[model samples]
Target: RREWSFTLPAIVHAGTLWLMTLLVASELDWQIALGIIGETGLGRGSWNEIAWGLVPAAMLAAVGAWRTWPVTSHAQAYRGLAGSGLAVYLVLWVVLVNLVSSGDPWPLPYLPLLNPLDVAIGLVLLVLARDLLAYRELRPAVPHLWPIAGAVLFLWLNAILARSLHHYAGLPLDLPAMVQSTLAQATFSIAWTVTGLVLMVAASRLRQRLLWMVAAGLLVVVVVKLFLIDLSGRDTLERIVSFVGVGLLLLLAGYLSPMPPAEDKPTGEDAA
Candidate 1:
């Protein structure tokens, strides 16, 4: 069942967190270790921090496991606990950011605590939120493709307009700066365009024909930017061709593929 699947991942995540804690302790002194942990803002620094952070995490894991128990169905409890864990994590992130940014020394040597792990945690929370949202039947009826499409258009247009205005004013844009700006713009444009194309393909009601339109428009704009760049003839064209080619491939894939169906409902049949 889907709920069981969710539960397993949650358990794995909690275990991973505990394992990470052990590793941290082994690598650092107690004062530094406690500082790093407290700086994470999952809980306040005191006897209560461990009680709050680890206890809730453990409880959520237990609830998830219970969802799989044959005698007792704890799906609702699992959902509530998981949602609470996510909220706690988000609040901690905000508090930690503000605390760190205010020029306070972390209890540790300011270890890079915020990394891919945070992203992984955020993603897991998003998954939990999606499930809870769906359970309440509050899922969006309309696909979210257009908003992404609009963002892509806005960024692309703004970049082009800025470049044009700079040129008209005869402002001396340095070569390195120009390349950096162009690359950044191209990166965001390609990313959003790909997302839009994917959403268009996946949503049944979305017009597949429009995928090509968006692709073509993006291609034209990128091509124009490349041409306007002051690079040597062959190198400029090659760079342009390479990026455009990849973008086109992604667009083609999105246009041709259909969206996957929503996940199946979890059956409460698995035993813990």
Candidate 2:
């Protein structure tokens, strides 16, 4: 026995199928368009590779995150659709960054942050962060690990960029030995301290207590490293600069974006 007609369910399923097909077709169209433009070779160069990869993913992500779909269902298909875009974008980002940073003909310059790939990645992250903040309800619907994963990616990129700079100076590839030097050690500490401060500012702007705690933990690690390792090294311009820079950043963090307020527990009187 049936309490309802099959008509609505049928229409919904049909609509989902239609949308899925449209998305797949659009992906194919992108590849075909790239072929027509004579940039069909994947892995020939960094810019061309990104054109064939990140550009389409970015477009899909922007569309999914921004557009409103009419169909709604218990499975929350719309949320999944949007999450798929984010997932694909992130996966492609990891692949491209590794490829470009390692041995691409167009390696990241001495200033890796200003390189095209990192700049694009940073802009995409900023836009995604803005969208996520604007649509609060979408937060729980998307993958929960993205925030932590993004932070890890940021840290890893900074290390890779630093390594690139070190290699450019014709230094040996021995990481442990490299860190023993004044400049390398200072670079590492400064990068971590700056990263922590940036995260603190972001946490304050986002009103996220968890993010604030994570930033605090990162700062603690930097402090521990400073005391244990940096203090043992001879005083040099690099070391002095690192210490001064960290001090200024700490002051800025305190002034501009203090720790987020702790959550208040409900008391008996409040409950009443």
Candidate 3:
């Protein structure tokens, strides 16, 4: 225990791992900025650069994943080592943004949010969240929050998709455009409602009061947004459909999912 408690070996290991990770990440950033693999197309030199950059990243991630496993009692020390490596791997997206561009019209159909880079980053977050955040003995509150994070990410994607569609359709930024966009944006509202309903059902199945409350919170947000924002276009067909659709979904949710029971607190003797 003494050896594991921020001792010299642990400190040295953490520092070394972080330093190596930073170095590799910096190299990858340079490669991306130089457009080793970009719109121009791939070449042997590009492949070499990509291979060099990704190989190090993969190695670091492997080391982090291996160290993160609770195979021993020194979970805290091990987590530090794991985080040093994994943190860089997770944040590589941020480091590689703003790559030099030709400044020509955007060739991609989707916005930056839906680009391959962003998609890859989202996937990485989902893949790493369970390992990095879910350990009941180490951190109880964390496991409950992944759902919220996922919900936020899902909502963001839906919104960006709606925006991209509006752009692709060449909708002008005006009142009529707003009316036209009501249907497109209503899709996001529907998605939000569905996400809440799913969460509610999951909460009921898992019998988790916290999760049920989270689901309720999401539903409340949808309701507020519907009344405050969506109501502006009350005369629009999209708004009518939204109201009817959401109401029906809520009714179905009420029938299918009930609130989870609160967890019983330990009595004084039991706690002792």
Tens-digit lDDT string for candidate 1 (47-151): 232223333343334444454552144343234434445445544533333222221122322112232222233344344344435443334522453544355
Return the TM-score for candidate 2, rounded to 2 decimals: 0.57
Clash-forming residue pairs, model 2 = none
lDDT against true structure, model 3: 0.58
Query: Cα deviation of 177 in candidate 1 (Å)?
Result: 9.8
Q: What residue pairs are clashing in model 3?
A: none
Model 2 stretches with alpha carbons more than 4 Å out: 1-45, 48-52, 55-86, 95-111, 123-137, 142-146, 149-153, 156-160, 163-181, 201-208, 229-235, 251-260
Better of 1 and 3 by lDDT: 3
CA lDDT scores, all candidates in order: 0.43, 0.59, 0.58
Tens-place lDDT per residue, model 2, 11-123, is: 46445644664576566556644653334554433454344344444544444444444423322333344444444455556555653443233433445556555555565
**TM-scores of all predicted structures:** 0.33, 0.57, 0.62
**Residue-pair clashes per candidate:** 2, 0, 0
- 125, model 3: CA deviation in Å? 2.5
Q: Candidate 2: what lDDT?
A: 0.59
Clashing pairs in 1: 68-272, 202-259
